[model samples]
Target chain A: MIWDWGFALEILPVLARAAVISIEATLIGFALAASLGLVLAVVRIAVPWTSWTISVLVELIRSTPLLIQIFFLYFVFPKFGVVLDAFTAGVLAIGIHYAAYCSEVYRAGFDNIHRGQWEASIALNLSSWTTFRDIIIPQAIPPIVPALGNYLVALFKETPLLSAIAVMELMQTAKIIGSETFRYTEPITLVGLFFLAMSLVSAALIRSLEGLLNRRTTR
Target chain B: MGIRTLVAMLVIALVVIGALATQESYQVFMPGLLQGAVLTIEIAVLGSLLAIVMGVLAALARMYGPTPLRWLATVYVEIFRGTSALVQLFWLFFVLPQFGVTINAFVVAVLALGLNVGAYGSECVRGAILSVARGQWEACTALNMSRPQMLRRIILPQAFVAMIPPWGNLFIELLKSTALVSLITLSDLAFKAQQMNQNTFKTIPIFTLVLLMYLAMSLVVTIGMRLLERRASLGLARGKAA
Candidate 1:
């Protein structure tokens, strides 16, 4: 049949479970990316000796496709005696791939902070850690929230790549349902709709968050 | 040596050492990976050309067309941009065949990549066009130039310069995305890498080679786009002087 409502209903629960996997992967991966990205940015700034190495590593990650990285982690790491399950492998690949992007965003935010703030912090005898925590990070983070949110949506969409190594996320689940029932219209369409809805909701949330941050800053 | 140069040399030395370690597998995998790399470039170039056309049309429709056309453009951009490109590819590859519409795998790859990038490029096009000075539009109207003449002669040249940098990013994104086409059974770089991995189980060498190929392609795209952007801006500068 062209479009089977019954088949779509039959597969809803399965797809929904897979959707949870997709969402969880996105959230966990994004968390790893955010923290790792911040660390990379900090190292590039704070440790001059290592900055070039960090820059090259980030560029190497950024230049390649996420699919290749996933394949490398999934297939290649086992050769080095690091045998991660598919889920962990997918998360690590996605996390590090996007950490490159998030680091760039963080770098931009840090660059935008005025030099006078650093000078003032130094004048006040604040420890570097206290200065970053009290003065710099608060200023840097608000501006980059929207950019970070965009990556969140991007990461959510990218969770489908996990399927290549057999993680069985939403798109993979949809593909299985399609093959089983020989009905492509329902499950695939539903998957697309689910992505579109989640993206729109996240975009809306990001906009409001940006506005809230801006208002607080202005006040 | 400066720290940057020293670090760069160190990284190169490490890479050369790693390559020496995997030297034997290079002969087995290089030819297939090279062939796949060519296909990846082919897909990226063809897909980018289509995306630029779609982007310009959709951007114009949204910007200056009638309300219905604007609405249609908005819907197209939102739906395509909001969903995963992988889903779009799967839909084209798997779903269309069910409806008695059969497109070859290569064409499906091009269309899906083109459409997804086009949706993003449309926003850049729209933003660049809008960013053109209000006075330019008013000047064209004052001169009694027709809408087409105004767009072709005045607005588009300025907007084109603005669009190039974002278009470059989209082009690179399209190149990276071509790896996804391997899923539909195209013998692109990622697919060849996978095939070689399964055949030899030399995963480290095979994947490292594929990753470097992709990085090399990305560097080519980045350099190529920079040249294009420079040329476009030079033309714009000469136009202003004239």
Candidate 2:
């Protein structure tokens, strides 16, 4: 038989546990991306002199493949006296890599804010912090939520790359299972289905989030 | 100009020059890496061509083909797009042989990456075609052009320009994805770097060279696409074309 139902059923539990690691990595990495990306975006905007250097950094990170980035973090950083474990390195690599892409999205979000809004905040005698926190970010973020959500899904897909560093995520776990049982079909197919289902679910959720934001913004 | 920028620049320069300064070590690594890069470029180019063809075909099938073909194309896009390229690569490389169908790793790499990128490219094609003004389609109908003739002679040329930048992005993406092909035991640059690292334990130089090579390749794609876009839009100059 091409696919053994019993074997698939037997391995489902092991794959599910590993999937939690993948999900945890995605959530934590995305949180880092979302936050670090905002900092990178804000730094680029606020520090006019630093913009050139920041952009070059962003471009450098963005252009290189994430796998190499992960490998570099895993393999090379120890030479510089910074050591990180496989999972930590994988998550950090994923976080920093996506952060570059996310910063661009956030920068675009910040750009859409009208100049008058900044002027109004200044006219109201608000501190820069108050202006950004109370006025600017709230406005800037809603429009870009959908864009950020897309990255969330993108980051989830990238969780599989962590397997390269031996992070024991779903993909790596499945690979191990495949090697152990020599049944690549079931474990790999299940992992693919899990990804497909999660992506579809997240996509639908993002659509609803878009609808929610649109209605709130329109009001 | 600032200290931070200077420091960053200096660090990068030192790393790069440090890697090159040692001629003995450079000789050890550079040749193997360059050979791997050639293979990487070959796969990327072939994969990109296949992606463009599959993209245009799938986009057309989804947009204007018979209902079943449309459904098939949609499924193709969603399935391929939904899964990570790595999974798709492993499946083809490992699983397909179970059914008594075995292909070489290089063919598997190209097929997997091409089809995967093609799924995303179909959307680019669809978006570009949709962005072409509604009036163009009307004019084609008014001229009594057949469906294929209208798409071929009238609709596509205009959409082709809009598609270039997005296709350029996809091309770079395809290039980066070529790195994944290394995972399937193909001797691409990434694979070569990993191999050399294992052998020589010179992580810094080998990986740095590989990263720089990829960055250079992506920059070339970016520049080439910009030139193509300029050339494409030349005939469609706004006032002149009208």
RMSD of each: 3.5, 3.7
Residue pairs whose backbone atoms clash in candidate 1: none
TM-scores of chain B alone in all candidate structures, in the order given: 0.88, 0.89
> Model 2, B126-196: lDDT tens per residue?
99999889999999999999999998999899999999989988998899989898888999999999999
**Candidate 2 - chain A - TM:** 0.98
How many residue pairs clash in each candidate at the backbone level? Answer: 0, 0
Highest TM-score, which number? 2
Query: Which candidate ranks first by lDDT, i.e. highest?
Result: 2
Report lDDT (Cα) of residue A18, candidate 1: 97
Error of 1 at A58 (Å): 1.7
Off by over 4 Å in 2: B1-22, B235-242
* Tens-digit lDDT string for candidate 2 (A142-179): 98999999999989998998988899999999999999
Q: Write the per-residue lDDT of candidate 1 for residues B138-176, one digit (tens) a residue.
A: 999999999999999999989988888899889989999
